[model samples]
Target: MIEILDPAQLPRARAVGALVATILQTAKARCQVGTNLLDIDAWTRSMIEDAGAESCYVDYAPSFGRGPFGHYICTSVNDAVLHGLPHDYAVVDGDLVTLDLAVSLDGVVADSAVSFVVGQGRPEDTAMITATREALAAGIAAARPGARVGDLSHAIGTVLRAAGYPVNTEFGGHGVGSTMHQDPHVPNDGRPGRGFKLRPGLLLALEPWVMADTATLVTDADGWTLRSATGARTAHSEHTVAITRDGAEVLTLPPAA
Candidate 1:
């Protein structure tokens, strides 16, 4: 389902977006060497509860994933990329971790993700994370009224390809509003001007992720975490954006310190 927010709903959307962003930032800061993945999930839950916001993930049963995610946040470590279910695991130095989160505030929803090294950053891992971040930025810049969804996809794909990372089409960005995922699937790679046309009040979560070696993915025994087929490292970055008259407004930006 595609949802367009009315002017009155924008404020709620902004609030949810801010909350999601702040939670991700705080979780990232707390993730260090030896930190348990479950701890991260707990932190996310506390933050959401304290804000009186609802988690869009917990109890989320989608066809693509196993029923009831049963977690407050997605803690994707090392080779893991999407739908990473938090388990009994401790982060180590140089481990690339991706945290994806979505929450509802005042009946509006926003989703975002971020990837970074746990402790001492690896040069290659850092580069991969930077590429995804840049790709996300490009995608957001293309999200303007009258622009095609393909334009955003193309912009995101261009950055990943230029960075020498293969693009995966299976999972990508999507419409987000009252629900976490909605219609108008936004692929990471597509021809410009060839898909759904953007309109004012349209909210989209654009994410760009890539494996260091292969584009293929393998599911973990847990049935949720998706890891790279070759065990190569990976990175992911995402942001929630709202189309407007002049351009796109990034609702899930990190709060000013």
Candidate 2:
């Protein structure tokens, strides 16, 4: 179901967004060449508790996932891309890690993700990161009020395709608000003017994820995890946003130090 937040509800959404941004930034910064995946998850738990916010993933059990997420955050390293459950492993130098997070503040939800290389990494990894960011920005630019969801998807595809990367449609953005995942599943590629229409008060998470060379995706041994079809590198970036009369507002910006 799609949810449109009244203007009054936007303040809460912004607060929730801030929390997500803060948590993600904090987690990403602490993640290093030798950081442990379990430690990252624990740190996420601490930050959420400190903020008095609830984890959108802790008990989340979508049809695609195994029962309850049972983790504080998603720590996807190297080949692992989406729904990467935090595990008992330490990140080594050159590992490309993606931290995806979603949380709720006063019942409002905010979701975001960031992909970065650990310990200086490889040239290819750096390039993949830049491409994903460009794709994400393109998608957001096409997300103003009155633009079709397909317009956003197509914009994302155009950027990725031009960058010489393949798009993944199995997963993309989705309606977000009081709930982590909601209506109008935004695919990475589609015909412009197709799918749902955009309007003020609508909240959506526009995520663009791509692997270095393949369009296909493979599920990892863990039922919830998704990886690139090719054994190549990957990157993903996302943000939670609120649709406004003028345009969409990106709610999850890191707090000013």
Which residue pairs show collisions in model 2?
none
lDDT of 1 by residue, 114-163 (tens): 99887788899989999999999899888898999999999999999999
Query: What TM-score would you give candidate 1 relative to the actual structure?
Result: 0.98
- Residue 57 local lDDT, model 2: 87
Candidate 1 clashing pairs, residues 3+ apart or interchain: none
CA-lDDT, candidates in order? 0.92, 0.89
| Model 1 CA lDDT for position 238 | 90
Candidates in order, TM-scores: namely 0.98, 0.97
Positional deviation of residue 220's Cα in model 2 after best superposition, in angstroms:
1.9
For model 1 the local lDDT of residue 80 reads 96
Clash count of each predicted structure? 0, 0
lDDT measured at residue 56 in model 1 versus the true structure, 0 to 100: 91
Scored by lDDT, the top model is 1
Clashes of 2: 0
